[model samples]
Target: MVRNYKRKTDWTEKSKKAVKNGQTIRQAAHNYGINESSLWRAVRNVSAGKSLVSLSEASQSRIIFFLEEEAVLVEYLLKASRIGFPLDTSTLKSLAYDLAIRNSKRSWRTQKSAGKDWLKGFKSRHSQLSIRTPEPTSIARATAFNKTNVGPFFDKLKQLYEELSLTPERIYNVDETGGS
Candidate 1:
């Protein structure tokens, strides 16, 4: 009884080492060129609940927190960008992106939500955070503090009026005492 064998995708030395060192399947896939879902399955085949259970308590918690935050942030950014929000990625990874060929493989589904269905499961966690921070109309007018000409200068004037809205003389007093 001869059975046709599937050619094994050569796992790199680094991937083997990572697996030995108890790195997650996804980590091995990322560190090497292995498929994430495939790597997970191969690891699972070797030992049931072995790799998953070996995860350090701190590391597991960290990943859960990180994923929760990432899901929320992704939704926030996509919505904000659609309606035209600030284009700053000050907190971005600040690294160049590379593409990974995704595998259609999946892990054994535990008694838990999986696949695209789990994508927004933690979205309600982010709903607690207020994305729309309304700037005070007065202070928001004076965006550029150092500009000497036109736009910013005019804004300063507007700011001054709001500041002294209740004062009688209400002079901006922009002209500081001449440089002594």
Candidate 2:
């Protein structure tokens, strides 16, 4: 659920300044069209030595990783997907659990893995990541077809053909697929 507050950051700052400049909290809040309670809290925070510029909106307390950490995680997921090794939901959850453990975050209810709610929240935060059923592929087929292996195989085949002085007419092509 998103909160559509009527007051912007400048408005809150103006209200706080007005209260500081002898205007009553009610008058400042009414003039700026901000909630009185919120304005009061802002004023209180200012009085308590918190800088006015530092009084920005707070993030959710339940977030396990910092913004930068989450960004790194998102990048890792993207790289993994680009490499034809996209992680499933369970694997993602397990990874999240491992991350939390490594970071010493023990606030989660489930010790084994991240909960479904966390995954849902993670997906919502990172719109680029979507859950999809990946097509089943054989391990050999997936691993053997990459450029690092194919390039060398072709180079070796060329060297072999050159060493044998093979001619195009004497060469035979084999079709493993049994197609005409």
Candidate 3:
């Protein structure tokens, strides 16, 4: 019951179903009510250029363990870690973070990752670009500035700022040295 360029969610669901049915992307789009370009985008987004995930021994074991766990904490931790949440914290800390993160927005940037299949195919056939390396980028400089070194620089600045002042103890430093 799909119509062309209808609701986005409807399109996605129909597209996903069509793909699952072993239809080629163009064929899938044709039957499921979308254009070739739209179908390509959906397929590319889900597959991420490489083949779809298949169940393997390791995957099966992981699934079994995840299902058998007393709490879903391990599964929760795994999902959280993938999205850049801290999973190494103590139980209480983990719980706190888990609770706090419920309202945080999910990052949509993963789709824009270079491995998208449509992008890969398009670039390969037309632009001759690979996901790992696009066009020629800037050559690496031997002494490129690293943002990671900025913390120490700021600490030194704080020291310098404090040193130039008459009172050091009274100076309220907002940042703790090497703040975690």
Candidate 4:
């Protein structure tokens, strides 16, 4: 379920400023109607030299990849998809795992691959990509309409028409060849 939590950046900044200017955490949180711990964290972040906007925009959970790294990954995924070799979720996870391993990510030590939660988050972050089951195609059907078969069939059709001296009006397509 999605939370309807709206961040009051203006009020948060005001609360943080109040805390910085000698107001207690409880008083600031109560005055701003924000969580006391959250206000404390915000004040701490401000003291640590992070801007209020960055504090407000920061995600609660740590992202596995940086923005530029994710951008490169997104580009590769799109290019592969356009070239008719789209990656499935499992393959994507494996690739992510390999990337993490290459980058020496400590958290990925115990896991074989990136988790489903990571895939969910990745999909949410990148709106352009969507998961879908591709329509199945039989090998015979796919290979049946090639130039080798189509050229001869059309040639035979032209020959039959010429031999029979058939006019355009004489041609008719019938669905049923059976009659009662």
Q: What TM-score does each of the candidates earn? A: 0.21, 0.50, 0.23, 0.51
Judged by whole-model lDDT over C-alpha atoms, candidate 3 comes out at 0.47
Q: Which stretch of 10 consecutive residues in model 2 shows the poorest summed lDDT?
A: 52-61
lDDT of 2 by residue, 1-180 (tens): 433245445877778878878999999999988899989988898789886443233435567889887888889898887665888888888888888888888855456888877888788889878655676879989998999979998899899999999877776555752222
lDDT of each: 0.47, 0.78, 0.47, 0.77
lDDT of 3 by residue, 78-100 (tens): 45544545333233233423433
- Choose the strongest candidate by lDDT: 2
- Which prediction has more favorable TM-score, 3 or 4? 4
Residue pairs with backbone atoms closer than 3 Å in model 4 (clashes): none
Query: Which candidate, 2 or 3, would have the higher TM-score against the true structure?
Result: 2
Output the lDDT of residue 178, model 1: 19
Tell me model 1's lDDT, rounded to 2 decimals. Answer: 0.47
State the lDDT at 47 in candidate 2: 88
- Candidate number of the best TM-score: 4
List the pairs of residues colliding in candidate 3.
none
